[model samples]
Target: MNDEHDSAFDSVTSWIVAALGLLVLVLVWGVIFTFTVYSQALGDAFGLSSLRLSSIFSITTAAFYIAGGTIGILIARVPLRPVVATAGAVFGVAIGLLQISSSYLGLAVVFGLLGTAGGTMFVIVISLVPQWFEQYEGRAMGITMAGNGLGIFVLPPVWVWLLERTGIREAFVVVGGATVLVILVAAVVYRRPPELRAQGTAPVDVAWLRSNLTDGRFVSSLVGFALLWSWYFLLSADLVGILTTGGISRAVAATAFGIVGGVSVVARVASGEFADRIGMRVTLAVGTLLAAVGMVVLPWTGTEPLMYVLLVTFGIGLGAIAPLFSPIIIERFGPANATAIVGVFTVAEAATAFLVPIGLNLLLGVTNGYVVPLLTVGGLTLLGAGLFYRGTAPKTSPQL
Candidate 1:
């Protein structure tokens, strides 16, 4: 009887982990691919220059600041249906509306209004990971980060294919339509475990959120991540253009994107596993430096083949940054307040996304090409690395 019960318990545990894992997969795809693919299309349609392209996606990214916690609250209060389905609605509606879009307002409405809505769905997905694997939260988050890589790997070739044949609008319809289906599946799969719900108190503390956000060490994490995300998202927003301008063909550039996504697949998973086995402070520092190196190298390589190799390496290095973000929060604050703190950090990062890309555009206006912008990204990266190192350094006791 004892053996039978143990076996059944293990089976159920396995199922819940798998369900949580799949939920994370959809969210990761939504995060890494959807906005980026939209950014590419948005730029093409409006003659909206690359800098303003960030504006196109900025509203949705901005909404995460407000909505990330709201998503957690919804999951906390109701069954997972409302939170998950609402997210699905945003994704599906955004895609369906694509058939009607023709101008900047439409792009802003769908990408910003609807796209922001779609993106906010991810916070709920991530917030549930701790509920499923309380002690092993970091490892679970690492496992989940693979979803982003998977999306990155498959999405580029598919998006490039869609863009080439059907034009960007129809591509939206197809991708958006597919998103609705996944959203439904995501809604069904993601939930806070009953074990957590039975405890009465919420998984994370409300008071802690208020304290953590204002604290110095935590704020440093946010600032550091914002800089990291700015460059990471900027790369996603501009990869095709970057490679093509460096003399690689469009087909080759798209392949390079796929290569990045494929590498990111490993980076996300590896980063998480590395963090869990190692420590958040060290792992994040390494990711920041790798991404910094990746950002700087893109502008220097002269040959087409060399650009391809370096850009893919850059993508792999750059792509793994997000997985470390929540781990940093969890390590500092514990899992209970992870969502709220992460939401705040994400908001700050989104603001960086808005400002930095436009700033790069201005730099281009002044200097032409990516030389100055690349230099600026490298400087910010080094600055970010320095901040992390200093913040995490052993506090020296004041000299007696």
Candidate 2:
């Protein structure tokens, strides 16, 4: 009877963690990615150039992962509730600061704050879900990450409506406040499992990471992540711009972008479940390959219908790839090493987020087309797929 009761309680708590994790990703990643929708509005308001506009996103993204990886070290050793709550407070306030900033530098600084806090919250939320379940870990991670897809899908249209009605300033104020409130509530409710809470682990150190470097699997995963994220950010930084420039209406382009996110919602759950059956290595590789194929063909698609179809393909890969990061890491390194290991991958992600967009945008300026840069994205992502397959643990490996 006691065993049954414990099992029931664990089931309830696990789903709760999944639910909150979903909510957090919706707001955090959703708000961040919605920059694409608002980039035009921001540019119009500030008289900014494309390079300058991309820089704002680059700054935020780079800061986000860099902070996630750096601060994640500290978080591994400390109590989580206070740190996450403080991060929530900081994220909401920084977003609110966007309303008053008129200058490029000011906006960059403020967004850097948003990225830092959001990154912290994001990593924490992602880290927590896996601790709750062993059997459905992939699915849980997928479900949680689907919030990102949902947010991207849902928020753009909402932001469009809000921007039209209230303008960007008021939108920021309302949305920022709401984000703060939700994160605070989640922080209060989301706790580590008792088993995890009871473990008194030491902070991860450089020497330990150095030793892990000797493992080819670990290094391969890191390299694959960096390359994969480079491809992702390359597209993200300019997909809307590509559509608009291709003679598609802004509304249509936004819809296409949302299509990617919407499809990703399904892909996230499906890929997670599929990974459980066939193995995450195969799932990861196939997803990346699909995205690559879509990306390679995207520059050739002149019509709206084809663009939408290709984006759906890309979305599946996007959804599948993002959720596997933690699962793969935890599988190889163990849960105790999960947070710190993820932080290292976050650093790789940060490098790509910071540099890839800027580089691609610059390449676009030189080439006067998306052809070369996008082709580069496709090729690199294919390489990423191979690397992930090389690095990921096979299904036959003993479960941690």
Candidate 3:
């Protein structure tokens, strides 16, 4: 009876907790989607060359990730909600600055420096739930993780349309205004879980992380994650151009990406729940294989039916990866150091995100097209699948 009672309560709390995390993700990505669109327009307004425009995204992205790692460390030491609120305030200011500044140098400073200031807040939200909830981690993480897609779903079209009507300067003001409202909502509800509250101090278990580094399951997970992210970053930064070159129009490309982003919300949740019911290794391998299939078809997908099929296929895989990755941290590292380990992982992710996109840019610079780049993404994901299979613990090996 007590067990049943505890589980019922746990279920309720978990859903609520996940919902809070999801809300934070939505607003974070909402601002992020809008920011990226606005920055691109700012570059266009000034007649910056393609190389110069890419540089702004490159710098903003690089700084965002490197800072994300540091922000994770900070969250481990501080109250989680305050960090988010502070980040929100800074994000608000960064957007406001764009309203006044129009030069490339000005955009770089505001986005690169001021933008990075509120950067960690979103990272903390994404990272915290994994530590707080363990057993239902995937489902919870998936639901919360969907917040990003939710924003992508709701925000991008709105952004494009708004920018169409209002222009870039006003877009910045609107994006910043939205951030202020959402962050305030998140700040009030995004508290640490009761389990962590019982402990008081943040979890920082060094031994667990050291164990994880040596453990086969954890290592496999890392490799798989690296592959997954490499593909994701590559596509995210280049999708519009890549598909368009294949003969799709810019308007169609935008709509396709918007649909892809929207579909991710459902995909994230389904994959998370599936992982919980089955196991992370099996679920991830299956999801990744499907993602690889989509990659294979992407370059070849020219006709309308095939194009729509590939779009949904690619989204299905991309959406599932994140929720699966985040919620498992506590299982390996424990509550203590969960955030710190995630930070280290973020540092790794940040590096991959920067390099992968930069690498794509270079490939485009040389080849003037995306064939090789798309092929690389598919190949890496398959390679990662093999690496993951080999890295799993032997049935005889003791579990970490």
Candidates' TM-scores?
Answer: 0.73, 0.85, 0.81
Best by lDDT: 2
Per-residue lDDT of candidate 2, residues 1-400 (tens digit): 1334334323777887788888888887767868888888888887799999988987887778898777875677667788879988888668767777889988888889888888888888777777777778888888989988888777777788888987777777776777788789877767666666667565677777777788787788788888876667776667778777777788788667667778889999998899878877678788888888887887777788888788888888887888877777767666665567777778878777778877897888899998898898888888877776667766466433
**Model 3: residues with Cα > 4 Å off, grouped in runs:** 1-14, 39-41, 44-52, 113-118, 160-170, 197-220, 240-254, 358-373, 386-400
Residue 158 alpha-carbon offset, candidate 3, angstroms: 3.5
Compared with the true structure, the alpha-carbon lDDT of candidate 2 equals 0.78
lDDT by residue for model 3 over 1-400, one digit each (tens)? 1334323323555565567667766766776555556666777776777788877766776666778666675567577678667777877778777778868888777677543653575566666666655567777777888988887667777788888898777876776677676676667656656556557664445764577679777677567666666777777777777777788778778677667777778898898888878986667777778778777777765666777888787778777776766555445445554556566667778767768877888887898767777888888888876665455534455654
Q: With candidate 3 superimposed using the best TM-score fit, by how many Å does residue 211's alpha carbon deviate from the native?
A: 7.4
In model 1, state the lDDT of residue 82.
66
Residues 156-201, candidate 1, lDDT per residue (tens digit)?
5677788788777787677666666676776665554554344444
Clashing pairs in 1: 60-116, 204-336
Which stretch of 10 consecutive residues in model 1 shows the poorest summed lDDT? 1-10
